[model samples]
Target: MNLSMPIDAVTMLLMTQAIALVAALVLAAEWRLAKVRSLAWWSAGFATIVVGSGMSVLRTADSFLLYVWLANGLLVVAHLLFAKGAAAFAGRRLPGIWLGVLLVWVALLGTDPASDRTALFGLVNSALVAILSLKAASLLLSLRRTSEVRDAVRLGHIFLGHGIFYLAKSGLIFMPGLFVSLVGFKGLLIKASLYEGILVEVSLALLMLAAVRHRRERQITALAERDSLTGAYNRRAFEAKAAAGMALARRAGQPVALLLCDVDHFKAVNDGFGHATGDRLLSALAGILTDCVPADALVARLGGDEFAVLLFGLPPENLPALGRRICHRFAQSGAGVAGASLQVSTSIGAAASITGTEELPHLFDRADRALYDAKRKGRDRMSVESGVDLSVATPPLRLAKVARRA
Candidate 1:
């Protein structure tokens, strides 16, 4: 805890080694479960550092090879691995050519004169650690996302500060009146590094775990909210977003519109063409709806062969036109996804509510009734509940007999 006087340089090395080992183990365990590549890279970083620190602690009199060369080499590897993890987290990779050159340079460092090798290695290792840490921080800084921004930036700054500390250490060693002897200076520097390294290791562990947890949570959320077959919003996300959109529309004094879409003769398509073609038709239909709606609109797959589009800030009169657009586009596009012989069409039911007056559920009921009305009239057209238009055109009669009976 004493900043001016370290308890013991050897004790500090052992402590540093233990901290890195524990961090490595924790990251390795998480990597095993999550199977995240970045976690594995991070674990390798800590694991390498542990071995490097351990070599320094366990060095014998004849251990310049082990303590100076191999240990320092591993330390360089550790820094590079940490940088690699940062790049991986951001969906990137470090250049292999640059990494190869760095290792080659580390090999060349061993050619220093025997008397001056330790001093040379010390300075170079500090510089490499500083450079690698800063590189990792910069990589994290490049990611700007809503979900992971906080953790990414926090980790970036932490590594940034650690890098600056070592940069200062590497530069300050030769400054006058700081060290009485180079040997004493090296001892003190190791003690100082013990404190800094432990803190950095702990921070790295927590941030890594937190970032991974948050990322997985986002992935789970995406899976829950999306239709696997069509990539449209699932019913759950639709309802939630619809409510929010309705509220916004009311506040802005604009009407909210709902369009409920159904595939015409979808069962026949599935029966005749196999479910694969039918699925293609559905996906194509979803894409058509997505393309037809405004960017702000929400398109959802409500259930089997039933999809919904919710629009904000649109008048009731516009609903019929939007519905017709959806109906027409899918009619033209469906054959491309399946086959020219696979005839496909869509029936849309549309309703718009008085802004600041109608709730989403009430609007939903009106749209449902309109959808039933469309199914009764015939399939392959749109019906507007507010009566701007009862049908898009004379609908193709896929359900004419059933509609007449109804």
Candidate 2:
């Protein structure tokens, strides 16, 4: 078999093969460690592209139907899979209608007039590719906004560029006389397409790998910084975040409030019931803190039934109210738990920075003293400390309505 082919055809063949190889390598990486589902779909898409391009290169003049069905069908399926992969990456499910569209396209290819009109086939293929590419790009761009990984944004831009390129290629086909002239020239249009395709393939492959890496790194970081039980930040993370928040507050001339809360009778709950029940109480309390605090506030578990909250831009007067809200919410939540006999209560100590010059440790110490005072004078109450600035007023410590034990 003579392997010699037109330069443009050879280039397309090589580009498709290269893309397939890259996708395979990415899939292999996914299998070994990452196990990303989207990579597998992308690999399948690249494989189909390789098969389609190969068929286009090898098809003879007599095999018109075979060429139309295999070449065009594979390319369309490849784009569909690419779209599916993008949806998977964005954690979205593609609609069933997309699969139906592909089925209809294959059915049209089998029809009498549709398969015979090569120019019409080209136009439809271009339109399908443009649509799928644009859809994939939109999904990626939307994901970029909420994603912490920077590579996701880069991948979005790449997908957007690829979509725009295909849209331009499709639009050129509708131009008067230009499509015919381009089709008449054997190598020109194909060469341009192959060049752009190769660039897009290389860029997308690299960016996809980077995106996966960034996401994995973020997951690892979260595991390290967060408490495994409650999904709250651990002690170390809490201190680091508190320091950063205090620094920001100082610069903005805003007050930062710290609340140190300890479960009132955690040991009693464990002794009366079991550790599991105590764990449930702590988890419930964490949920209450999350719900009661503002979105900008940082809530963390500082180990062993103690939780911390850092609130920025809140005045000293508001600390008492926030603390009460947390206690009230936790008490309300405790009433609804399965073990009604096990009463859960919290003692919270709040300290607010008036001068914006106080360090996190000193502020924490003040809150800890206040928390001790709350614990000493019965549980289920909040103690507010008016630090350094004597001008700042402190609200009276009041106990909220306690949840009844069965």
Candidate 3:
């Protein structure tokens, strides 16, 4: 828990600069692998800060001392890059007003004719850095709110703390003694800011790495959970979602429904129009199923020419209407795809657990039976099965059938 390392006062700034360089390198390497533009912006920002700090260190050399304001300007630019990185991460445009911030700094520099303009602009520089850091924090927090990227929340907090620190540092200029004690070295050429800077750099580097890792993990999970051809939930994901959805609905005392949908004469379509056309049609069917169902519903492709929909919190009475819409929309979509010469449509079998007591497997079995019933009655239609009556010890295996034309 002792985060501190052995430090030499004279070399503290150099240590901070070294840490920033390493963070920049590591982030740049991650950018190469992940190809996230935000990482590139963050890395460049870190590198720019290091360059500015390095330039300030050169102030001991009499010739370089006069341009310390230049170093300060670069520090401000580094904060700008940090803000831009956050904007890119959140998919937002750069806040153009911040350019006015840099212009303000430039104007302050020209107003002062001192040999060391850094001393003159010290308060201004701190204020600008604080403003930029706060902007970055706000943008990062928005990323968390909008994208559900949990790591962005942590990064936002870190930047928020950094911004507040700089704001306090700017105010400390009024009390030179206290300012020196806080950010200045103990009678050494380096600064106390160096100590804090090293810690900040380390934190930023680790958290940004975690952010990119989190993104890559989500991408991998999506690939595994989705069907590549139809972009719907795969069989594995569908099974998982069905079990969980039923459990949640049962506990909430809400009804759940299952709709088993199969393409009518799918084999014939494949034979007549070729497999490529059939694949396109299957993809189109997935879209139709998604459009017809509620946003919370799960649409999955169980296998070739067959798909399933899991609905929760829906009344049993509405299931038939949804099935009819899906069937009808798919038939229309199919006709447009390969022309009206080929008759194409879908058959759906729907079953509902009105009492929220039936298990997923039982519901699936009932739905499968209704689906076949639809095919038997006629293709391009929807068939509804009787709802489960949990109060009955022996519920009827099969009951009423309502067939709706597509």
Candidate 4:
């Protein structure tokens, strides 16, 4: 049997296979680097595309069912896996019902005894691709809301464009006179579709790599800014964030407050228990401070048992109350470590900016002095400094509590 093929059709077949090879190589690299599961799924999807398109290229006059049923089915599965990969990248689950839909389509194709299966195959394959691509686009777009990845929006747009292309291709099948024939290898429309598919496949693979790179960059930055033990911001990150917050607050004429807290008798806890227990206690206290503060507050572990909180737009008058709350919450919730009923508490010194221009070190020093006063009075107490400058005698706001062993 003689088989006639368009030049563009052959080109499309070669390009699809090349795309599969590139995707597989990318998957291997990603697995070696981070073992990212999404890349694996996408690579599998591209391989399926290659197999399906290869089958299409090999189809002869006697092999109509091969192109109509098996090849088209593979393409549907490929798009479904692409959607699954996008869902995985976005940290979500794709519905199992989609897989069932593909299975049902394949079963229906087998049962149908239609003389011309061209339109049916086109409709089913294009519809599935459209749905899956749109779903992938939606998942990627949703990730943009919470992720700091810079390429999230770009990837989402790419997926969205692919979805729109498939949707238009599907709609063209239903419209009369849009194509010269229903055969995928013939007509100017088929050539256009082939070119568009090549572009989408290549661009999608590249953009997916870009998105992964962006996520890795964000992870690296987060690790640098975060403390290894407590998962809170490190002292350097805290100072940088606090400085920016203070500058913004000054510009907006909003008050900024700093709370310096020291875990009283932390050394005793280390001495009594092991250093591991002391670390657990610090982690527990970090959680408590995080929970007690407002959402906008910047909390950090400022080395050893000391922690810092930077509150923006909060009134200076509220500083004392915030300090008391931190101390009370830490004493109540952070008292025990790892089921051990060891008593623990925090001493907090709070200072608020009279003017936003006050240096972070100066404000921290004032809060440190107040923290010193709290330690002097008792372990489980709070002290508030009224002025940024030490020249003004700010009476310490004291919480009465019995002194504990250090």
**Candidate 1: residue pairs that collide:** none
The alpha-carbon root-mean-square deviation between model 2 and the true structure, to one decimal in Å, is 5.0
> Ranking by lDDT, best first?
1, 3, 4, 2
lDDT of each: 0.77, 0.73, 0.76, 0.75
TM-score of 3: 0.82
Model 2, 288-312: lDDT tens per residue? 8888888888999998999998888
For model 4, name the residue pairs that clash: none
Query: At residue 169, what lDDT does model 3 achieve?
Result: 73
Better TM-score candidate (1, 2): 2
lDDT of 3 by residue, 298-333 (tens): 999999888999888889877656766776677667
Deviating ranges (above 4 Å) for candidate 3: 1-9, 61-67, 93-109, 175-195, 335-343, 387-406
Which parts of model 1 have CA positions greater than 4 angstroms off? 58-62, 101-105, 145-149, 171-173, 177-192, 248-254, 294-296, 314-321, 354-356, 373-379, 390-406
Q: Evaluated with lDDT, which candidate comes out highest?
A: 1
Clashing pairs in 3: none
Error of 1 at 197 (Å): 1.5
lDDT per residue as tens, model 1, 1-406: 6667645656767877888888889889988998999899999999998888777776654666666667777877888998999999988888886486367546755584456455556667778888989999988888765346478778888889989988987886555443222233355565577688888888988898788877888888989999999999999999999888878787889877888888988887777667887788889989989898888999999999999998887777666677777777777765586545555778888877767458878778888888888777776778877643456553463421111111
